[model samples]
Target: MVVGELGSGRAGSTESPPPDSAAAVLAGLDEQQRTAAAAVTGPVCILAGAGTGKTRTITHRIAYGVHTGVYTPEQVLAVTFTARAAGELRGRLSALGVGGVQARTFHAAAMRQLRYFAPRVLGGPMPELVENKLRVVAGAATRNRLTTDRASLRDLASEIEWAKTTLATPEDYPARAKAAARETPFEPAAVAAVYASYEQAKSRDGSLDFEDLLLVTAYALEEHRDVAREVRGQYRHFVVDEYQDVNPLQQRLLDAWLGGRAELCVVGDPNQTIYSFTGADPDHLLGFADRYPDAEVVKLERDYRSTPEVVGLANRIIGMAPRRRGLPGLRLLGQRAGGPEPRFLEHPDEPTEAAAVAAACRALVDGGLPAAEIAVLFRINAQSQVYESALADAGVPYVLKGGERFFERPEVREAVLLLRGAAAGRDDGALVPTVRDVLASVGWVEHRPPPGGAARDRWQSLSALVDLAVDLVAEQPTLDLAGFVTHLAERANAQHAPTVQGVTLASMHAAKGLEWDAVFVVGLVDGVLPIAQSLNRPDAVEEERRLLYVAVTRAREQLTLSWSLSRQPGGRRSRPRSRFLTGIAPESTAARRTPAARAAVVLDGAAGQLFEALRSWRTEAATAASVPAYVVLGDATLQAIAETRPRTLTELAALPGIGARKLAAYGEDVLATVAADT
Candidate 1:
């Protein structure tokens, strides 16, 4: 039985307790949730898996105790990660006929206490709270003579956040970051210097950043007994949701709030702890049993969100993860009936993959599923463009989740403006090179900077535009810079600026705490899924697997996991499916299937001679474009052309890999070259 968000929306009588109100809440709950809700007291830990109704169980537990006269709604402090989750908990509790319970994010709770205690402890009103860290971080970066572009500044801000959340001092940042293998856009020392400057600037301005709210509140509670007693007296019972995401600083803050007592309840699944970069450590959640040896522990395994098939896939993927010591590999026992088996598909390139996914999403929408019940999730934000274009072209409405659309991003808009300006003036030389050159004026480079930085993010946005130019030129060789600008405008207009009440397109991180009827997880290739950054770090690859676990479980009925063999058209097909799928994907037998294995005698034929000539031509074209030889035309396409000996552009266009753009650009040359040889 599901009790929380999955349960009924009816509110109970808030005026007076129905004697059974407390017991009635327990009627539909499963045994585990009943035990958890019945605890009602200190030192309780609920090991809740995905879609297992953790929210429901906890809310019912609070309502059970409140109605039973064991807990006053005001005394129970329920803290979560986000405001939306807290609001949700409040609404759920209200629906269950319980009110006055304080549900809030940790920051919100800290800020409230800080404001109250600041006058007494620090002898003043609270310092002004700054909502954004970018301006301060940019000023610090400027002081340090660091690259202060919006992207670099944003990345630096993230670094500063990680350092502060982990309680790393500015002086300790370089060493601690190194020990932890933290990725930085700039050198460690440089980041440390900027960190010190930012902190100094905040102090001078008498302003507090978000992280400081927790820090200062913790300090006050630790240093002043009066403040601790008053605050702790006001809130006696504490519940922390998503406990696995609690970092050391937050734990310290929580410890302060608890006032050295064990009056606490933590509900979380360690497997879903994916925010380590933000300094979230699962150790606190994993070791809660040991911390309070007498804690009432309950594992909520019955998953109400997914089918048995989806649950099986989720279980298998997470099963392969190298276990963290003391981490319970909570297997979600599916409570729902079996559904269709999840699909695993492969596409030649990113565009085709997006188009295929768009078609699949359209099919699902046509099959009586609401558009909002479907989602297209990918590894990163840069992968959204092709999918957005494909979905828009298919006339499917969609909304970007947790982020703005790729084309609407500021960096992309700036780059497009730069291109538009360039097109307004001088010659619009060759399409791809002209776009590349114009973007380089805005700091675009041939090779991407390190991944996981604001600079890299900005570069990716610009690179998407370049990719669009490449793909556009491939289909329309005569498209000038002005024409390309017009094309981009048309694509943006068709989006309707992210239509509401539409399919969800989001990054995997953004999809957490959300579920859909049909989920299409796209771009599962090597450097993408595991991501290039995770390859070298200790146990980082396993975290990537856990990320996939999160993505896969977001589906209730239909799930499609797909990867691109190559990134773009004219790209090498050397990429393989993510290593995580090694045991799942079928084994390849290229040696047994290809005709090349026939014999060496075939090389003596005229087709063989012509194949070599075409291969030479491919190599020359590739060299001119500075791309792989296969990008011009794969071996199979060259061989097909050699065997057919097409004499006209029309005939050349008839073959695979020879589209309108390719024919327009290479048709005359190819026909002339073939006529000279044939």
Candidate 2:
């Protein structure tokens, strides 16, 4: 018999006494948390707010269930969104001494189920997982005589993924796309045809994409009773984290996994449901009580992550979103000490906004906050360029968290692999020659691509690789190619990249589940935050509001919500601050002009002079080298050099941005410039 099938009675009275191990797990939990932890027998819905210890509550609940003999560690299946989150859950459970709890992402859990059930049900192994569905879709479009460009191809790919994940087949795509009022750049019929062709091709190749992992598993469970029974037998208790973000297909998988048993618990905040674009339905989370009438609803409203001031701002912003049943507005009572009211800064243009944000970061760091404890978040990835330049100039080290890691880029990976092969047999004397050979083998052309295209970007990345080799050789004159390869491998395996030790720069979506001592939500203009693409749809706009809410709540202490009046200097103040900030009072906070807003662009004495000199050298070096200035020497590195006034070549090379290749190429010029100025 399923554990929760004993009828939806009140928690604990009918249950067995929990073991001694559960006492340690339940020690620090608040009344609400303790109650939720104890309600291990029935369906529980935790409306956990930001930083209210949702992870803590859920992990404890799982541990409590195991200790109380309600469920074994092997019988509990906990699913979250990301691999990082899943790993964290497993780690927490391990720390609590309850190991073997099957904590995984929805896709991971489904994939495991599919692998186990496929051979028995389908009489064959599961199809190979497709790594690049977009490429396959592009090919399919060509075969179907559907003319498409890169952007349209991407849209078509997304539509296909959305269709499949929503349980719609290719035949149903055109109708579904039209009915949903999806903003597809291509005709619905044309996209549907392309999707059809893409599906056929995937079948022909005997492979499945990421979306197929969940769709196929759900299908198997519904169609095959034995498969479903076997899965249910193995894992009986289910706990889902971030249930608000569950797309329809995942919900189907969850249902299939439960197999009519009500032994499940889900935790989410409706206000944090921001992935509607990917077909994630907040309705599932909102309608949990109705679905499982006996489900106990627990609201966790104590804000532990942010100060009272920051929490107040979050509560106010979320209140602006229209309310509905099951999705009530939660007013977080901040438990942390009071902090300064979140700042609302209005700038004349993007450059000034970026500079001010950089300056703010610098001030925070200089005032004793670690650089790693600060972040600059924006609505979109494109908005990071200006801030990246500004931060580089300010001598700040920062990591762009959401983008492709430096070593993970396709070109970089290929080059590294080639280098690894060459290093295996080569001696130190042949290292430079081996590096040159590896670049050539990997199609590295010496000449630059005509500016502003993917080709140019690839060329720059390849060029950077060459610079990397040169730097490595210089740093360790005796270190062979094998040693360098080992270093690269070690860096890749580490969770945080070597370069991620500085201030974090990330898009709002990527900044979720992460908190900082200070955060700057920049590019908050009308067209950017709600974003122009989302303007036509109300639901999309609401998701954007939630995105902003996510950004605001990421701050633990200081918060600055900023926007630029114009895109360029002396341009008209066409854009206004985001609509979400409309009812928010600007009285308590003040805007200040940064150096970028000044008419004269003053810098402090020697540092200012050094900055100018470094910029001049950078411009010349970049042009001659046919690469972006940032590639030659990031603004942050120059800023550090100017402020620190490193006296020797070694000192200059030791700065954060100056890698081995950089030190080899520009080390002499940088040291001379600094020495001459001093």
Candidate 3:
């Protein structure tokens, strides 16, 4: 069994771990890791941040347990949150000379138990499980006389899963949805009716759904003492990965399995909890101390994946999130050798942003970075159309991640159909106004729907087309509907190219748990990343911050963050960079520069911003060293540095007040701060 309790900082080397023939498993582990692997005490909680070798540490700990005879390989069960993660665990353990340990997802393990116990408990064969839960949900919607379509049906199915996973019964779904401020696809009562009818249909067919595996297994364990004793005896030790994502029902299953024992070690990071819509709660990991009272918590903050620049940027982003004061040790100290400071790019419009990102990816590939090792991640899937076209136009290969290409989406297809019809007779007048009416026919709302709902996602996809129309019209003012339709066809044909050896294009959510050698996180405007739906909600905004943190930590070396000021060129410059970047993007948060603060020497936009940042950095640096600000950089040199934006030591040395001695003291700092303003 896992042993120990909370709050003892930094594991000391005073105690030696038990020896094993496979003792080499403990070698190369850092002090904190060695302590975690050797601790033979109560339930353990590993606060593993992104890029930290939490997976390696846990595997070695388990392998050490087996080698030392503290654990029998056959009796240990490792539960992960995904099938891929579980497979990796088994593979890692096998490489460590440990085998026969059962590694499975919660659903997989419970389903196995149900296969064994359902027949005996029911005195008959198991009920036939539902092959497609969405089909059942659609059938139930038909029974309720509801007018439904494919997208809304998908949204309803997702809401049903949330309700079920959070343990809310159909009778209570309406109240629960209200309590959670959820935006259901249908009216609340209608949603509840469909949910109730769906449950009835399942009961009538004698069919169990996927979610039923967790509920039934836990019920059996709680109702039957024999089943509890059997499961507890068979698997004497349990280790749960991604514990931050455990919902109420999963936690219920975990509690039933434990039966008041403490043979559990849960590894997770509260800072990376971004799946709140699916009911993932960070508190489960945050409050581990209160739950077990005797749990041992280890903070795994050494990040071996990213360079110092990347880790430092990630830390600053999370530091500004709400309720951050309550959590400590969330900071990550980089372990890898230094790499390039992350680049921040600004563009006049989204088309420019997408094209610039594509050009950057192409340049990286041309510089000898493998194409497959690069990725372009955005806030939503709808933002991919421009990138797809841009990459195809640049002769760069790419793949759409998690789903079909943008032009293949159902809503996009319908909107394109409407646009085709408009080309025949309705095409007239100003192009932008005429196109907006066409898209509005397909449910493009003036205000976007709330976050975590299908309506918002559908809106994003449709709205992208409207923005496309804006860009197209600005480029060719006389172009009518027929010409735009032809343009769409050309772009779609280009996107259809065979795309196996290319960069990955995914939303921030899909990019989690995966790393890239070079990552470009685009669309860093206010309404996109935090999303318009989450602005007023503090909790939701915090989750958005966590999502950005996830995106930042995905890079192994080169990382770039970018945003556009408007949807089209010559448009208003009202769209500031994301406030989360308050950032390296100070213009996103600070007030306009006072007339007095402005450089007496007028400079261009980019140079002006860089000069202010350098001055700010100089003020702080001077105070820390008890020196005059000019002792580091006079205003004239700061302005010169900003105007030239020197990238290398030679460039800085050519400027005033910068020689070999000064470059040795402050060259890298000047370069990095200048890079931030780009």
Candidate 4:
């Protein structure tokens, strides 16, 4: 994954794949990458393209400095999306033998410094992490004889957390609580009480949720001169990963930590800025240069990840995004040469689409691609079920991101509650067993039943929870409480967890930092992809386009773009292809014929000769199977395969279009067709 001129196994050694040339050192980089990485003086802004290697560039820039001795790794601060990403970057640095670098998630970094000065700033001990804040809140309500639905409690907690991190105090909660009251469960006063209770609990326990770290640290540094001075002195250079995902809390923390002295290197793909609802603002990244006037800007205009065709499709889609405020322009550099045209697969319904996607994945993997090298991207987390069923049927290995797996399942959570409670010696996990027994025996708790009294509502709600637990316990008597929680955590931590298929089923949002040989973007229709709500706002529409851009670019070599025109299971057909697709011309020959047709043809055939070549090329594989290549393999996959000319199963597997089923079903036939000329 680390790319550079190499000597033997070492990266950045004298033998590194000589930087294509001095002129080509930054060739594979996007305009933003080069600009952000090279700027050593002040703040630099890099609005990256999806899969354009923003993370790679930031890490390497630090490596570049260390290699060039421009700055010690310790002097720089690297911030990323999650704790996992930060660890990955740190490992990458260690792999390159780069030492003294400080790479941590924004929250992690903020907390580290916060804890270092917590005693002085907050006048107390460091905060504890809220590993399961929702569970704690739910348990608290249960114990108080005022049981509430877990969902309601979680929603309330999340809202309170959001407000707090945005620097909203309990006093400020009334207005926000009022505006959100329509959607939230609790009234303003109730919310304020809960917020107070939640903070009290956290402070009493010396624990903090993710957001609290940023909010607390930002306030601490801004208020405490010694802390600010120490931080500014410790790290003079700052490199931020996924800069677009930096919420206001994070931005505040960054500012206070910088103290107007640090040289900033921030990199992110605005197109991948899907966390806006979570308070992240790409505006901070896009406006970096203006924020720091003397900053130099460079553009890494070439991409090394996605094939040109895929890149072209992604670029066109993102071009629809309204320009960011205060930025000159958005430049996407798709450096990879000719490959596949992104296909638009149409399915009859969700189930059918899931089946086809699963089949497609099977074809890719059976052909020789690694399971980890393929992903099925969808709009919503719930949409993954169909794909999961289809994949399970195909006996293909797959991993689900964002869904509660076996361990995180309700049953698993119950098990964990028992185990963790026991481990903490809650009277030999008595509370855990009691909670489980309560849910199992009564189904659910309705301590504060509806106004209809404990009749119809109370019994039903409690019964449901009890039934669930009873069923789980009935199925597995040997499942002790503590053992169950450990199992869930382990299951969640399984990075290479053996999936039913090698494919990854993730929401478009979760697929951000990943890349694969082949990618299938499903459920791309109007109400589904752009989602009906996003159709009105220019910014929302752009965000949708950016989401599409992210999905398309995740494909390293081959990509399949699909949409279902209808949602079945008795529902009337209502959805349409995304209007975003209206801008894209179809590739049918009939659509490509006249003089006036050329513009349409060029637009439809984003890559002219290459597009025609794919459509025209011989395909003995699918021909023998009597199915159109577009069915078994999308046009994008075919184009990439044709252009790349992957000679063997291994190489073909490396292409994104061919999945396990396709490879096993048509590998030889396709290769035979390719071998005819050679």
Candidates in order, TM-scores: namely: 0.73, 0.74, 0.71, 0.67
Tens digit of per-residue lDDT, candidate 3, span 1-678: 122101112222112334544468888688667767765444888878898888998999888888887887767788888766787787688777777778788988888888788876656677788888889999999999998898899998988889989999988899999888787999888998999999999989988897888998899999999888888887778898999899988999989988988988888889889888997767778778778777777777889999998999999988887664323456799999999878766555677667666756665666678776899999999999999877765556676688757788798889888888888885676877877888877767754543432554566667667777788788798988888888777656434212234678999999999899999999998899899888988888888999999999999898888777678755665686787887464343222545324222222467667878998999988898899987887655675576557677765665545667778988999999988888
- Per-residue alpha-carbon lDDT of model 1 for 283-398, expressed as tens digits? 89888877887877788899999999999999989888776776456888999999988877655567766765675666566556878789999989999989888777555667
Error of 2 at 565 (Å): 0.9
Q: Write down the lDDT of every candidate, Cα atoms only.
A: 0.79, 0.77, 0.78, 0.63
**Model 1 local distance difference test score:** 0.79
Clashing residue pairs found in predicted model 3:
3-41, 3-42, 4-41, 4-42, 5-294
- Report the lDDT of model 2 for residue 213: 87
Count of clashes in candidate 3: 5
**What are the per-model numbers of colliding residue pairs?**
1, 6, 5, 47
Where does the lowest 10-residue lDDT sum fall in candidate 2?
Answer: 1-10
Give one digit per residue, the lDDT tens place, for model 4 in 1-678.
011100012322332223333234344554456555555555666555565566667666676666655665667778876656776687667655575677677766776777778788878778678999887676544544455786788777776766765566777787864543324566666666677777777777777887887877877778878777777777878887777787777788888877877477777665678866455677787777667776555444466788888878877887777666765555566776788667665544566566556756766666678776898999888888888877766556566776544443454356446446555563343333554454544344433322331242233333333333345467676555554445435445532122322477899988877788899888878877787766766676777887877887789888877665457633444456677777673632422365222211222233344435445443544576687656666654554454445567876765554688879976776676566534
- Model 2, 1-678: lDDT tens per residue? 111111122222223334567787789898878888888976888888898899999999998887777777777889988766886787678777777677778888788777877787667997799988779998999988888888888888889888987888878888887777788867887888888888899889889899988888888889998777777777889999999988888998888888889888999998898887788889998988888777788888888999999999999998888886864556688999898877776656688677666766765566578877899999888888998888776566677787677677888788778787777756455566666667878676665333433454465566655665677778777766787778667556432233333688999999988999889898887788799978988878888998999999999998878777778877776576789888884531212334332211213455557878888888999999899877897664676566556666655654556677888888988988888888
- The CA-based lDDT of model 2 is what? 0.77
- Superposing every Cα of model 2 onto the true structure, what RMSD results? 11.1
Sort every candidate by TM-score, greatest first: 2, 1, 3, 4
Model 2: per-residue Cα lDDT at residue 228: 73
Error of 4 at 272 (Å): 1.7
Q: Give the distance in Å from residue 481's predicted Cα in candidate 1 to where it truly belongs.
A: 50
TM-score of 4: 0.67
